[model samples]
Target chain A: MSTSIVPSERAADRGALAAPLDDGPRQREARAGRRRSATRIALGGALPILLIALWYAATAFDWVPAHKLPSPDAVIVAGIDLWERGLLGMHITISVQRVLLGFAIGAAAGLVIGAIVGLSRFADGVLAPTVGAVRAVPSLAWVPLLILYLGFGEDSKVTLVAIGALFPVYTTVAGALRHVDPHLVEMGRAYGYTRSRLLLTVQLPAVIPAIISGLRLALAQAWLFLVAAELVGSTMGLGFLLIESQGNLRYDRLFLAILALGVIGKTTDALIGIGERALLKRWG
Target chain B: MSLSQRTTTLESPALPVSLRGVGRSFGSGRKELPTTVLRDVDLDVTAGEIVALIGPSGCGKSTLLRQISGLDTPTAGSITIDDRSIAPADQRCAMAFQEPRLLPWRTAARNVQLGLARGLDRARGAERVAELLELVHLSHARDQRPREISGGMAQRVSLARALARGPGVLLLDEPFGALDALTRLSMQDLLVDIHAAEPTTIVFVTHDVDEALILADRVVLLGSEPDLPGATIRRVISVPGSRPRDRADAELGELRAELLDGLGVPSHHSHH
Candidate 1:
């Protein structure tokens, strides 16, 4: 690319030129900005550290009863103990497995539903209202109905997670399709794409960023709902461990379980985000 | 290429679009309150003819293009494409609007491939995509998303997409109007070259008089508000030769003057 811009230029000539290729001060400011943002990100990261430190201090000084609040070290010890017992590993695996299963089911169903709702007027007319009404009801509300119908087992929990997970995928797809530039749709139409090709290629791809967002939300819900669904009805999974700990009033273990859930959720969300950035790089 | 040169017989070919006394009214049919968008719109876009539609905004220029592309039907007349009556799912004619409209989830190359199905097999589709990306000078940004490119580059990819299926007719609605002058000029040159090489029937719409004069074999201007009942055949300017059609020529200036006056803008407004 051409670099450097000569100054003896009038505005008209400058307009004729593309935005300047190079500027010394501009480059310096850009470097300064990179440094500033990097510093800010580093500094901002410490707030969490400070919060943990405060939590430790409050516990160390006995500001609250040990039963009421577990110290950071106590939770860490509990995490280590649970890991040593093989409880943490097994529960994490089960939760991950459950999230993956429910996510796949919900996301697939949601994608199909989204394409239909986005593409077909008849399909949308038939399904959108029903999906809308169903979405209004939280996935937790279905627990009672599922338990009564299928009883407290893995099926109910998985099903609940799937139900919880489905709406976001459905909504993201629908909204994305709705908002997809008519410009692109027109481009698709002009290219002589058949109906199926239009949907699978143009329609589906156009709505994917939307679908990806839904998948992330669905994953979170899938993980979160797994815990809630596992709470009363299960002998396995992290929620069972948490509930069991709560009953015994082993506050440190409860804190550790809760922390583990947060950590897992955050990590999984970050991974999905990574997947999205990768896809955007390739596709976008 | 002229309309008469090409062989347009398809396996299931029928009359493309023959608008018989086709006119459009924008409001309710009751009373005289309906705003007439088009009147006595008698025109037939053949299987392979690039007919440029030029007019002022709100003169139903876009509406006319939409009718031909099957986005809507004329209020009073019928329309067709590839012999079939116009429907929402009709695929005879492809269109690209002013915006690039690339799917953010697909790469620039894949965005162009959105139109390559049925007619183009896998290998050929890949070849067409490569050729089109090259044509648009965007293979370097082929892996980038729409957000990563400039407005002009996105529009180029959009053009590539429109050309992907070897469409019977290609419809463009102010496709390059969004770009800067230099970008617009380059895109115009690229469009002319692609049109020449591929020989696809192209109907390019734009408000720029120079753009219409430069790219189209025939420029059909849509008349304005208070154009009033009877159809106005507002000058069909023809300038056929090569790229960068002589901007200073007397014939072009005369035509530009008349068009600007009809559109109620001063002739000086043409350049800006």
Candidate 2:
């Protein structure tokens, strides 16, 4: 509704400003919109700032033992130490590469299989139940079984991430197909669009908003499975860094690793969010 | 007509349509009871003729139009265009539904180009799209999405899209049904203008008696008495005049009253 209201009001104000009259009202309206958005952003940022302040106070005052909870500055120093030793960047690169590869493989399979199942009732009946059952099992539960077959290698970790990413994309696409407006389908048929043409032009475009959100969910799952995979059986990655630091009782490095995980997770999700916003602006 | 003139018109010929004992029914299978929507309807739409189908709810006006457009088939009858059986892939016909049904993702111009999908080359399709948009007075809204425009503007885009394919038979299912009274009036005028510029055999469906009188060459009322099971052509009243005439014409008022009577609805207006 904010979007709906803003454009029309701006248009009205722009038109009024074109005429020979006072521009005070238009200026005030523009200022009010800016002021409201500013306030909203400030309000949204308040909780995180407050939490960080509490963490800093608790750590700096040694309210929690220094060994148990390191100060923020200590974690920063640990980050600097890793950076100086060239380990931080290497770990991040490895994790990012693994996630990207796994996500690509998963998404490609989901796109094709989801479309087939969505469009064909026979495929839905035959394939859906088996997929649903497999997906219902927790993603991490696959780790041990996959390790047994593929061994503790990059293959097992990447495959685990792929499995995690696949189901969300498939389910979202299939659900979107089912929910497409019947009116649009009728219109397409009336316009003489063949079945394949209808799928590409009308059905696919309509499903995009749903698919973007689904892909974002899948990416989040991919990250989760990556960390877990590394924790169980990897020598190089963020998860490995975390377990290594914990064993050395270097709380600062452990905290640093956790911070890196949070930052990377938020950054990737935000990137997807940005893409979703752009898509919805056009087609949502 | 001269040879050149005749050839020009042949490119987009207004093909005549005929319905023989056209009837449609639904739900005739296991765990489903049969219900008839139309029964033993017979009608003819001459080349370049604009006929309006009007009736109350459950009168099957839309169902009839769908059958004519080859979007649906008759259960117990036949429909033909230029005396040949209608085909599913027939490019000779285009239809507009009660709802505009423009794809929300595409801009108004792109949506219109959807009608030109089959044969026209890319350049020709784009050119035709521009021409059609201008015809419907929507050239200004070419790049705007459906949600950004007003309802009347969106409906005009739908009309332009229907015209983009150069359909010989243009079928409209209450195209102006969703607009307000003022917008509906303007849209009706726009439809008249489009029909004049590009003559096509049109079969329009509406519930408005005045709309039927104002636009159609002939109005077909498709309903029956309360006890009747299915609707047929109760009456086909010919409106005798050129279109773009005054809506307040004395002859149209009288005809409106008579048509209302044919639909079993009493007319309530006082003649001035």
Candidate 3:
């Protein structure tokens, strides 16, 4: 929405009323805000540094057995060794590919199905209950069954990830479409728009924010399922590296693999956030 | 103008609206009590006549307009335009509501184009839209979305959209109600100008007494009677003289006082 003068002036009045009887000067308020955020940032950084220091102390004092938890330097060395071997790049690429493919399939299906059910009461009554029942079954619960049907190959892992991604996208998007502003619908009718035209022009644009949000959730779920799916008979990927390192008693490599997974998940989520911002700026 | 032909050709010549013994009620059923909003409302707006329906709140003024436009049907009697009953989807009666109600996502120009009936080609439609924006003094805001424009500007866009269909009858429900005082006066003048340019049978609903006397050929007062079955036409006062009447005319001032008196409000100026 556009911030028109009347409403903004009213909002400013509200802010003044909510403040103390004597409010601070504007410059003082801005300086105080900056100081508060600086303190917050310092506090936020303190915990991670303290945790790392604790880990180092534990290792330097031999408080814990060396085999159980690797030192930070040992994990860094393992990371360097994997990077030198070129295996890290290959595993990361494979994992990314699996997640992307599965997410794309699942999101496409969800969008189509959600549109159908969200707009049609008949489809909703026929299909919604069944989908709800299926979704209640856990994502990993489909792993062994999908492998039995599709074999322990890329197909089974991808299917598992797709299954994980589907429900969030479908449920959220359908909910968004169902709750579209009724006034806009009435306005469309007043303009003499046919039902299909109204759906495409008014309803779809109104629900874009929700659709973007659902896609983000689906992508995150797909990554989670991908790792779980790789636990079963996968020859390559971060998940496979995780299992291999554990079996060989290589704690440093195991830590390195886990750290890599965390970083990749965070990076992908940040990318999705950037996409959300751009979409909102354009369409909102 | 040929390309912008109305989808439905109204059978009569420059159709004037006629509502005979029309009464409307809401919520009628086995379990629900029917509440009558308009009762025995008889009104005949001749072609090119600007009639303003004025009343206190809940006096069924808007309900009457809706019945005439076929947006909602009357329960008791029939409403006819050019001696023919109209349907809800008929394009002969176009309306502009109190709120501008322009689609938020569409630009001002595109929103105005929504009023064009089926057969107009792209070039003609665009031309018609540009002309309408210019008429409303919104040529600069054609590319702006609804949110980018002020309330008065948005209302002007909505008025342009209503006129785009070349509607035989125009219905307005407090079209300038949301505007500031200065904007409301300017918009009232704009309405008079638009009516002069394209003369159509207009039914305007408003609560503003001076506004009714200023723009209308006749002022209709619907009395506010809460305990009655519904509100009926209390008075229909003719406004004398021609177009572009002086806003400070002594005759209009006297008429405003008379109209206010009909609504149970004695005017201070009249007493003096």
Best candidate (score: DockQ): 2
Per-residue lDDT over B72-165 for candidate 2, one digit per residue giving the tens place of the 0 to 100 score? 8899889999999999746689998889999999999999999874756676677778888888888888999999999999989998888877
Candidate 1 vs 2: which has more DockQ: 2
Q: What does candidate 2's lDDT look like per residue over A38-60, in tens digits?
A: 99989988988898888899988
Give one digit per residue, the lDDT tens place, for model 1 in A178-246. Answer: 777776665566555558876776777666667778899999888878987888678878888899998
Ranking by lDDT: 2, 3, 1
Candidate 1 residue pairs in backbone clash: A190-B94, A190-B95, A283-B106, A283-B107, A284-B144, A284-B145, B14-B83
| Model 2 ranges off by over 4 Å | A1-46, B1-11, B225-228, B268-272
lDDT of each: 0.76, 0.88, 0.85
The best-first sequence of candidates by TM-score reads: 2, 3, 1
- What lDDT score is found at residue B231 in candidate 1? 42
C-alpha TM-scores of all predictions: 0.76, 0.90, 0.82
Model 1 per-residue lDDT tens digits across residues B24-135: 7777857768777677676665654556777777777777777777777787877766556777735666778877778877789988888654654576678778888998
For chain B alone, what TM-score does every candidate structure achieve against the true structure? 0.83, 0.93, 0.92
Top lDDT prediction, candidate number? 2
